[model samples]
Target: MKKVLFAMALALAQTAWADGGMDILKSQCSSCHNLTGPAPQTLKELWARKGPDLFYAGNKYRKEWLVQWLQNPTRIRPAGEFYEDHIKPGEKHDEIDPATLKPHVSLSKDDAQAVADALMTLKPKSDLIAKEKIEEGTISKSMGEMVFDKFLGCMACHRIEPDYGGLSGPELYTAGDRLQPEYIASYIRSPQAWDPKIWMPNKHVSDMNIQKLVHYLEALSQENKNGK
Candidate 1:
């Protein structure tokens, strides 16, 4: 009787937590974020999106990172969520229209934790997550930068360091710390798998190259962590 009662109490508590999180998300986050499933199917739909898709947040994010980030929101994409609307051609390169990018709304620590927990429960792309495998590996920063930038041309749109590369894609310097390795690999292998109309191309990168990139991002995160 005691065990049964305790179990029932725990289950009820969990259900309440889930309900609270769902309510918070709907009320505070739904306007900008796509909390429901099915990523943008067409260019028109994609362009209409105001924030990153959270339907597959379980498959994409690191829970702890999400909690921390939600409380202390920072701009992920150098340009706004939709680069096309934010970018303007400059003499040397494309620049972000400062006025187009609005700051993300920050949550209190409790709310951040609740939202992160809720988001981690929304796993829509299990197949992609299941097939991914990453090793505990790393690369030298210089060599990794060479391969990612000079060879792969990733620097053309993604930054490996602060103010060092293009401003279109989400910055890569913090990728390892902010995203799941599996997600990084899966997205690199096929960006279209996650979002059909996302600006990122399906590079169809070789397994070898993908692994190298993952390791490079890990190394970059370590370098940042160590203040180097």
Candidate 2:
């Protein structure tokens, strides 16, 4: 009877926690992020989106990373979420002032935790991520760089090496540290499923290459972490 009663109490506590997290999400995050999504099917719909969808946050973000980022918000995308909207025609990348850009909403630590908890519960399509795992240290830095730049053409929009690559997409040099490996693979395989309106196009990359890319990212992040 004691064991049963304790188990019941624990379950009730978990349920209450989840409910509180959901309430926080509905109240604070629903405006900018799509907590529920089918992803935008067209360019017009994509351009209309104000923020990245969070329907797969559970699958995408590391819990600790999310908590830290929420409390101390920073711009992930250098060219803004919609680059076309922020960059004027003929304006150079250096010309845009970071201070002029709209900042992400910051949260208190407690609220951030609650929001993260809620976001993590929004995972969709478990099968998509079931087989994915990061094969760390499998790819050499030079080889990974080649795949990122030559095969994938990711360098066109993203910065793979801080001072290198395009200014449009988020920097990938830190992606390994910032994102989950499964999230990276899933997002690359089908970006539209995560954010229909995102500017990233589906490249139809092979499964083998996707794993390589993830491996490269993890290696790169490790290098950065070690101050290499």
**Alpha-carbon local distance difference test for all models:** 0.87, 0.79
Alpha carbon lDDT at 111, candidate 2:
77
lDDT of 1 at 97: 87
Q: Which residue ranges in model 2 land beyond 4 Å of their true spot?
A: 1-7, 89-95, 131-137
Give the alpha carbon lDDT tens digit for every residue of 1-228 in model 2.
Answer: 999999999988877776887887788878877788877778887777778778878877888888898899866777676666676545444433455579888988877887777778877867778867756449888999899899889999887765677767788877887788898998899876666557788999998899999998888878877888
Residues 117-197, model 1: lDDT tens digits? 789899989899889889776678788888888878888889877888878789988888899999999999999999988
Model 1 misplacement above 4 A: 1-4
Provide TM-scores for the models. Answer: 0.94, 0.85
Top candidate on TM-score is 1
What range of 10 consecutive residues in model 1 has the weakest lDDT sum?
135-144
Residue 143, model 2, lDDT: 94
Which residue pairs in candidate 1 have backbone atoms (N, alpha carbon, C) closer than 3 angstroms, thus clashing? Answer: none
